[model samples]
Target chain A: MIDYQLLDALAAIVSEKGFEKAAKKLFITQSAVSRRIHQLESMIGEPVLIRKQPPKPTAIGKRLLNHLQQVRQLEVALSIRSLADENLQDSPLTVKLAANADSLATWLPEALMLPKAEKVCDFRFEIIAEDQSIALKRMKAGEVMVCICSNEEPINGGLVSALGAFRYKVIASPNFVKRHNITSVEQLTELPCLVYDEHDKLQHQLLNELNKSVPKYTHICPSSEGFKQAMIAGLGYGLLPTLQLGDAIEQGELIDLVPGYFIDVPLYWHYWQTESPQLKSLRNFAIKVASNKLETLA
Target chain B: MIDYQLLDALAAIVSEKGFEKAAKKLFITQSAVSRRIHQLESMIGEPVLIRKQPPKPTAIGKRLLNHLQQVRQLEVALSIRSLADENLQDSPLTVKLAANADSLATWLPEALMLPKAEKVCDFRFEIIAEDQSIALKRMKAGEVMVCICSNEEPINGGLVSALGAFRYKVIASPNFVKRHNITSVEQLTELPCLVYDEHDKLQHQLLNELNKSVPKYTHICPSSEGFKQAMIAGLGYGLLPTLQLGDAIEQGELIDLVPGYFIDVPLYWHYWQTESPQLKSLRNFAIKVASNKLETLA
Candidate 1:
């Protein structure tokens, strides 16, 4: 049987991303952390960590991490059941959730705000900002307890539920529209387009449907607000969530390049089947908030 | 002599992160792109790109990329100089910049608004969000031409200048303050702290200065706005930019755990010494805009 203490050392090293930091976090000596990892390696008869600037786990190491995280979920549920005496007040559980930036820019904050209304304030969350395409991979790697992603597929031992959907419309500043005189599909290929990054293909997918050629010029802004600001500044034109446009379209600050056309992006909440009761209810609350704010796919 | 076409193929492959995408971007067949890379590899006597799912360039390949990007910078300068009679109106130059998320969350948007004020809008920008420590690494690898970082040391063939500064204050929501009764440094360690990510040492550094122990609980939010929202939601206390904390603290929604105490973060612009005239002027405009908005380091 593997010692759980050794596994905790490995988890801490990966979580903190360094031995020194892991030692600080675990309140142990740096060498002690190293010794625990070495003992684990000796027990398994294989090295678990790749010795790099910030170390990464080997394949078997990743499997170990996944198992430990699931076990942790069970422990968290037990703790929540024992919260009746208010024993777990000071010790807030650190939970990680992976969500795309676009959702975070609009309705996810409101979903997170549900905890405040319910008076469930015993959790500290790390909202990992990731592209929807990559968020599920992070969850599969056991890096997060819950994920808000576009992929509907559930990982092994995971449960997924529909979190409603959002629609994106092509938008540009009034000054940009007037400057470029964008009137047709061909003109859009000629004008500059903005994207979150190369992984972000909303612009590419939309443009391919309209024109044969990819965007002649592209701008990549990795931040949600920054991308919108870039759009509002007449830097380039690209897709924006209709929910986030708020008054930009009506106030004449932004023009929907394609008024009726939209690409609906449906979101799914992917959580561990063994997710703690607190996070499970939080996930349900998120779905409730999302359904209230976002349009239904049906 | 090595062919510039081969180098361009290598660049497009890396920029687009795949051969198929590079083929589309370069308006060449995939085989033609492959042949160019093979030719370049034969010339270098080493593999330029690793054949992974998303290809990565070798170290020597990075040196070659740095060289080509510099050449491209010169070409852009030439194009701008020859921009008489609006000849180059249709073709916009693509520029990549690396920035810390904190700036993007605050005054960077204002700084980016300069081009519109000056009627200079022929460039497309891709702002790569990264931690300040890691931003320089990407810039050094020639992933970006211009970088906004906290690093003071100038890289080879790079120019550095002050881009003003900002201050951070330790704050929490009024409810968090009341619930935790955080009146002393001891109480701080007892409460949870928030950091941008594992790469973010701002919270740890501040707490290390205040107390010998690291934060007992550290929540990591990777996005700028998400991090602030996590703080505002009373998930944890953290170091937030004073500029971003405006109204939240004054409006009685937040309380400064350390009143009048602050950590000033100075920013510097790191651009290539061979920066184009167009970009140089834009960089100067950013500096001017930043100076007007951000506080002086002194």
Candidate 2:
């Protein structure tokens, strides 16, 4: 077990970069900081900090540093929570969330605005990819209070509620269409198409819809932000989430081909079946936000 | 920032549920752990441990503990990496993989049995749906070396090779079939069906093939393993992944309904354009395994 003082010393030293600077930051003597680092190295049986003019952490030290930083952030969140508990009549409510990259990049950002909603509680967002079920397991372990996933089944007693369906469209840059003389998804084989990631389903889904195979030419554009950029760059014709494509389409950067043929993915928000006030507030707020953006299943 | 020592102390205390027990675990005096807790609270200006008889952590404390655990796991992984680097004459290789839950629960565990898979290098597996475009983004991020998705698009700088088309059958236990007396996918709405998750297109795909909407009474089965279990438990009818259903069907635990109709999600392994040794090894091995099990697309 590490001593609190020692971990504090490590954080201070890493942030300060040198014994002298760390000493000033921690209000300790430079020699004391050096001694503490020595003590930590002895205990861990590994050299954590590299001794240099501007000291840098070894891989071990870097890992330790990151760990400490996360701990500190948690502590900070806790303090705020405590203050809310004392000052407010109601306890601080946290809305734990899980979402995918595209959702995180697009509509999920609206979750940050939930705190400002009429709800009188704190909201904590844990944005994750839709692809990560392990995170869902964490939610099952009570790590998160709520999750927005394609997974409709409740994990470990979570209440499953339908949010809505998000529609996606096969899109390409106007320049791409003109350059390749393409009009249909079949022409995708002859042209490059932007994709969110290697595991992205747009191209595959496109082919499946056409009762054809996936095209031969594809470009990996992993980031949602970058996906738009890649489309504009004419890297390839890619599937664009309707929400993201709206602005680009307005700007004449991309064109929605065979517009009515869109993919609608049904989404659901699963929440821990708990009776906490904070969680209730979040659940209601999420429903309200999603109701506006997502198409309710008729 | 949280003092690392405080986190360590909290973990010890949480595990033991008492100061004395925690001290014993840490080989420190009870007073030492108590003092550290107190010091941590003061530093963070918040109370993390409830100081109850058993000394349970507050929600904030729990959050900090979770973050610390994640960091610690990363640290251990990094440590193992360093040790491997020092011992191996061959350069360390990292392989990134994207897969789905069905594969994860069934075929994937056996697929990763490469000799010295863990010892010589690091393998990061990113779990996603069998959708191809999702895998493409990971490939673009340089995060995954290969993906098992339903896309056969030749990535601009990558190669697209067929793994196989996995066939899924609409299945139900004999008990369930007898109870429901179901005949066609149209009667699916009348009988409860198990959906893998909200984003699972299986149910929707089934409904779309019939040009109908998803039924109202469909039960959400989020996990692949759990979904199988639920189907076996006669919770509902569902489309079962072929690999998982084979043995169970043979054993009469499950029975196929509407047998001739199946969803064939063709899988492909797309690798990066680079010739990195780590990637080459993974690509060849994956191809070898896939070829044995899957039909090639030529």
Candidate 3:
């Protein structure tokens, strides 16, 4: 059996980036931390960390850290169960989740504001906003407890739920529409297009459906908020999430380029197959709220 | 001497997260990719990757990848210098940078729009929006070529420049201010505060300056845009960046709480000491633009 304390020390070293900082966090001496790491390495019969300026974990160390995190989650669940009647007021839970940038900027806040999600207040959330592909990869790597992603297929031993579709409409500032006189699909190639990034194919996907290729000039704004702001400021035209554009569109700040043409990206929720009440509560709340917010395809 | 081809294959595998996908990216067979990785491990006399579902690089692998990226950058610089008269239109340079979210949302855009920065159109930019601490860490790790951060100290073998300061003021929606009747610092604890995240100390920093503790109720909106929107929607008060708040305040959407109390966070630019013309151009352009945009300290 592996000693969890030694594993914890190894994880701390990687996360805190040094033995001294890890020792400070763990409230132990640096020598104690080093000894624990050494013992763990001896037990595994291999060095688990590179003692560089900022120490990094080896592949075996990463596996050990991953195992430690899983064990920690189980322990937290056990503690919560044991103290069921204590209301969990004193001990606040921390939930680490991976999500796409668009979701975080749009309906996610409202979803978290749902009455059932008030429990979210009792928890600290570490949200890692990333592209859908990267988010899914992080989820599969056990880096996050849950993920809101575009991947429909669930990972092995994980629960997956359909959270409806996020519809994106090709939109631009009202001024940009008037200046460019963009009415037909062919004119789109003449005007500059705004893309989220190189890997972002939303603009291309829409253009491909309309049998149009990407324009020569394109502005890439990586942040979802920056992308919207750039569009609002008449930087270029691109697909904006319907949920995020409702207010802007209503205020006439943004105008849909081609009416009745939109791309609906199906989103899914994936969580670990665990008996943790907090995870179950969050997953159910998210699905319920996302279902209400996102467009449902019949 | 390390084989850059094998190193590239290893980096691709770690980044793409799968052997098949890495193979596809390199335009090589999956078996060939595996053989290169095997050869690299044999050459290094140690395994360089963990064969997990989503493969991860070992410490040695990570160092090798970092070295490979640095070498690639130098090679690109050499090629650019040799083809100086070719106008660099055919070959687009890529500059990876790290910056705070607030900078990305506000002044950074205008800085990128500067006349000198028009040449930036020739380069592809990968701007990673992260906190100052994390940004500094990534710079130190050599993951990013340059970073806009709060750290004034230059990293070893790097250059640092002061980019003036970003001023933040306590701001609330007009309705929220009227509803709460917040006139004194003592009443601040009664109202709910909006924070970007737990790491965000702007609110706390302001409160600390005024000798006040944090409120009992606080709302965490991690995104810079979301934080501003939440304030505009009367969710809670927050320390809004002066650059972002100008339009909102002028439009009467948000009101400043204290007339004089504002915090100015000094920002610095850190980049590698390199003879690369692209790096020099970017550094000079960024410094010139940021100096003009940010508030200079007397």
Candidate 4:
């Protein structure tokens, strides 16, 4: 097994470009840094450094540096969560999560509510527009702990857990629908439509389902919050996450245009396939929250 | 103009969960942090924080936090590069580049070398899978300064510079080709093929071009290094970049089959649309290197 502490020392040394400076920056002795590097190289049976004027990293060293950088970020986040947990005496792990704008504006908030709340882990959410592959990359990079990904294929070296299917319905604010007298999605192309930027295929997918062309005149609102606000303010019609419509539906602010049709998006939870206690706790909490929210809404 | 520093402070405070603690972590005074937060809230014209118990970020603050995180990373990278340049006294603006595996194994190294040393900056490369959309996202997220993207459509917030085109030819080690007695591509359908993981479209694109069915016995090589090694080791014959094969062909390591027919991929340079002097220097270096390489090779 790889000693993570050695990897961390190596990454710091490589980033600083010398053991002396890395030691000074890390508040450690230069010999300690040197020893750590030596031990790591001996363990790996490969020379990781080219001890030139500035001590360049060998190819293997660079690869290890990249991996170490990712690991270091994860460590930092874990440390912060630990600190937070100690301070609060309840919150333990911080699960940094990223999802699409519509999903964040829709069902994600409700999914943050933990049922058991055993270890007192706090959940942090971020809305990003990356595709599934990119989402997996972020997860691996340790920028985010959990990713709500569209990919059915499991990311290499990551745990795969199903989050059930999320369906999207073509929706419009009641005022906008009433003012435009909109009924079916066939007239979608003619009406001004709000979209989640260029990469968002929700509108295109809906148009394709209706066997109609994608509208040429469309306004780009990249955030789900902004998209929902725009639609409510009568900017345009859009396909919204069914969960996003719940409060609006109850308040009589928004309504589905085409009742029978919806796009079902299967979601999965992908995390780094590690045996850390905090990661497992986060995974369980997310699964529980996802199940409860999905069962209640779907 | 948005003050990036304010956003970073806000994100740190939100992540830290309290004013005093966030200040201590950032090595700043609590009053300073409080003032910054007030300024941010005033500028955004929204209450960004909930002051009850451990502070929580408002929904808009959370959105800002995500954007600020990306911006903070870019700012950190830029600062690190700037500091490295100041200390190293030479090659301060080393460009961190990202590309697909095939390009890295093939034309990218050639393009990295400028005819004149003065025309080049220090270079660092991160090779990834051929999914250019992911590369673009990485570039946008500040993981890389430059990227080779396939999509002609401009990355929403980045500038695009054309780098001519790279053509991929179906090739194999001469020994393997001779051993298999392969001539026509139709025969290739019967032979084993190599692919770059499931997401790779190279072999599929070749088959589509030939109007032939995909070979069932496909060897998967996930990395560019692995793919090249597999071809050299005679694991299977597959498409190789024309640039990558040049030295191999001359050295009698590889042979092109039906050389006239090849896939032409128009490559483009995508970078952040910033006017920073460091970015400008790196951009100019890339353009010079790319143009010189293309002129010499094409």
Candidate 5:
């Protein structure tokens, strides 16, 4: 039982970063913003903001902000549904989501292009490209309304839907294979390999399957595009997503190190289990698109 | 006083995520990897890694990994210096660094291009497009050896160098400006604005300076390139870095709302305080290049 007005004030203060600015954003007086925050703190029985130069929300405050944002989103969705004008020009629905870089560069745009999503909603998409673990954390923290992550488990009462497998192949530029005379896993050990990040386990998984050791030297490129560019530049060989590799493979810019050996990373769509029509539409669209775009494990 | 061998085994385990895989990576038996970890733990009197599926490092373990990585970089740098063949085909020094997205999209490439860096080091860059706060946290956690961040303060004995100011101008597409009939800061509130993330303060700061309130709605695109693309697509107005906006502005894609009202975010380069030659070269190059590229306040 929270006051939407007070919550609005809180969100504005956090986003605008101070009482003075928050007051202006809400079109209220500075004193009003202060009083509202004081009321919130009194109700919560704890300080919400650190009250620094650029004010930062405390852990509890951050959680409340997340809560407020979620509530606001639900309200927006409800309003969208209640509107009689089906042809309303501006849908007023903003969806904040997080996804991995590979998805952002590939199937995500297609998934978002579902007719229902495009026609009904004036979709304002705020997409954050992050690692699966970080994306999951953001979703749990309520920083994002939805997250495309590898984790199958749902948290904070979120709904989880399978998005099929993202298959990866150990790939290198044609020049690298010929220059290193790499025909086997043992040869790969002597050459530098490219990794997405320290948290990336795909290369190790491939080597494990091959019964080969990790190379002493490795190149790390945290961005999906950078990883691909590095491989194309002959910096190192790496496990690249099939979605991203198709163009390069067709162009003959890259060659599969071992054609038959591949790893399939299963992806899941996680979203808050809400009755909002917008969320339902998004969920259905995502599932349908992912199934079509992602590789099937048959 | 720490055994590099045990640390290497520990790093391998954390990166590879299993004792068996770590053993294979280290070219040792699984029993030996286990024995080394056990010996290291007994010496330290604490567990270093969480023995879970896809293992994670403990707080102390993460710090040790950072330390080991730093030590390895120094060893490589020293070896490069000692090599008799100055024209050695490939220098083995790999530098792992973190930088903000704006920097990565702008002046960082030129900084990395200094002749000494290219010739003497085989750069393995992990470009993390993170905010200054997160970038600072990662640097403090020893996740990166050097970071180009906005934080002026030094942490964990890291050296800090001023890398001039990154000037930002509030801009919008010509079409957006004409559609909204935006002529002043007061008009901005009626339209949607673009934000880098929830933590983005530049828009608020601009509004505060103009004595205006923040808009009720904003479009958040966390990636630098995406932010620019959104603006180009006439999504919203935003405070874009001058470096990123140069070509767009020249091509008549964007127009500055207020000619003189700009925010100059002072950039800083922070790195571990080490006498490593590789770090020295990188720091020097960054300072020189940043001074030439970034704007300076008189």
Candidate 6:
């Protein structure tokens, strides 16, 4: 039988990023923390951790962490169900989710509010903002319990459901289009543009649909709020959600470089097929609320 | 003498994240990319990359990356000066900066505007949000060219200057304080609180000043915008910047739990002591803008 103490030590190390800090959190000595990991490695007959300055988990270690997370989530739900009545738990349930920043800035906030209003679960969120194109990695890497992302393909143990879409437009200031004289779609490749980060593919995907090569010059801004701010400041033309850009588009403060063209990037919720009671409620409310708030995919 | 080709290959590998992608970017075969890395490793007599899935830089690799980045920055500045008469460059300069999310949401945006207003240099930013408590690691690891952080200490080759402070207060919904009957600071340790992440130290610092133990329950939210939304939604009490919470506090939508008590987290601009012409201008303007906008320390 695998000892949870050994698993807990691994989880703490990953969380704290060092044996000393992990020891403090676990209320054990640093050597004790090392011994637990050694014991775990002996039982598994494989190295779970790569010993370095601030150790990192191996592929097997990530799987073990995933297992521990799922088990702990189940334990929390079971305790809430059996020991306490209603949505009361000994502590607030932390639902770690990976999501695209655009969704977080717009529809997801409203979706977050729904669970609280409907009394689905008394939980707190730990949101990790990843570019939509690569958010699936967070779930597959065992970093998060669920993911609200652009990718529809679910991981092996997870289920996927449609969660509507964010309607995005390639936007620029009037000065930008005027300065570059970008009247035609084919001319876009020569001008500068904005990308959320290296992983952001919205600009490329939209460009491909328009039959243009990627813009040679790009500004990479990782913050969603800052991304829009940079676009408005005429840093470069790039795709942003119309939900947040409504007034700017309507008032001509920000012009849609592509007049009528917009990308309906569909969002999907990827979560464990087998879920705890609290998590099941979160999944239900997130989908229900997102469907009501976001642009529906045809 | 180190070959620029080998350094460029190493930089591309780090930027593109893998040999295959780096090969595509550099217009070279995968074997060529491997050969360059092998040559770089041989010259250094130490491994540059960890050779894992998505190869991470070794300690020496990071220092080499930092050197390459600084050299590239100088090259861009020289070209901008000689080849281009104006702020015009072959490509816009990209300044990768590490900053806290709260700063990004607050005064940093205003500071960002000043450079563009003055035409310091035609540059774009790549921002990485690391919590204020641990942001120095970004500079030490060569992940960012510059950093706006709370840490005042200068690194080996970098300098730090005061950028004023973000005044923070312990806050909650009026209903929350009443519901918990939390009139005294001692009772706060028992109630649930909100934290940005494990790396965030503001709450603990405030708690220490208040002579209280760490809160028994906590909610971790990483996004600065969403963090406030959660706090306002009565998810949990947390320390937030008064700049964003001024109207909320005055209107009683959010209450300052510890009346007349605030923490001024001093901000600093950390950058290389020797800077390129474009970067020197940026340093001048960022400090100028931030000093005017943020809370002045007594």
Leading candidate by TM-score? 6
The candidates, ranked best first by TM-score, are: 6, 1, 3, 5, 4, 2
**Of models 1 and 3, which has the larger TM-score?**
1
Candidate with maximal DockQ: 1
Stretches > 4 Å off in candidate 4: A1-94, A109-117, A120-133, A178-184, A295-298, B1-298
- List clashing residue pairs in candidate 4: A91-A120, A92-A120
Report the lDDT tens digits of candidate 2 across residue range B5-80. 8788987887687889899999999899988988878887888887656676776676666566445545545665
Q: Distance from true position, residue A59, model 5, in Å?
A: 22
Question: What's the residue-level lDDT of B6 in candidate 4?
Answer: 81
Pairs in steric clash, model 3? none
TM-score of chain B alone in model 5: 0.88
| Whole-model lDDT, model 5 | 0.76
**Interface Cα RMSD for candidate 6?**
2.5
TM-score, model 4 to reference: 0.40
In model 5 chain B, the worst 10-residue window by lDDT is B113-122
Give the TM-score of chain A, superposed on the true chain A, for all candidates in the order listed.
Answer: 0.95, 0.65, 0.89, 0.67, 0.88, 0.94
- Tell me which of candidates 3 and 4 scores higher on TM-score: 3
Candidate 2 residue-wise lDDT at B242: 79
Taking the tens digit of each residue's C-alpha lDDT, what string does model 2 give over A1-298? 6675776787677656677888998888989988888888898899987665466677677666645543443554566556655654233333335665556545554533444446555332333454423346535533344567676677644578887777778777776688678756666655555555554666787776775676655544344544555566554666667876656788887788777888777777776544345555656776777788776765
Across residues A7-121, which tens digit of lDDT does each residue of candidate 3 receive? 8898788768899999998999999999999899999999999777678777777667656667777887788767774866545566677778788777665454335324532
Off by over 4 Å in 2: A1-85, A88-95, A115-117, A130-138, B1-298
Cα displacement (Å) at residue B186, model 5: 2.2
Candidate 5 regions exceeding 4 Å error are: A1-79, A83-91, A100-124, A131-218, A224-298, B17-20, B29-38, B50-56, B81-91, B114-118, B212-215
Better of 5 and 6 by DockQ: 6
| Clash count (model 3, backbone only) | 0
A48 in model 2: Cα distance from truth in Å? 26
Model 4's CAPRI class?
incorrect
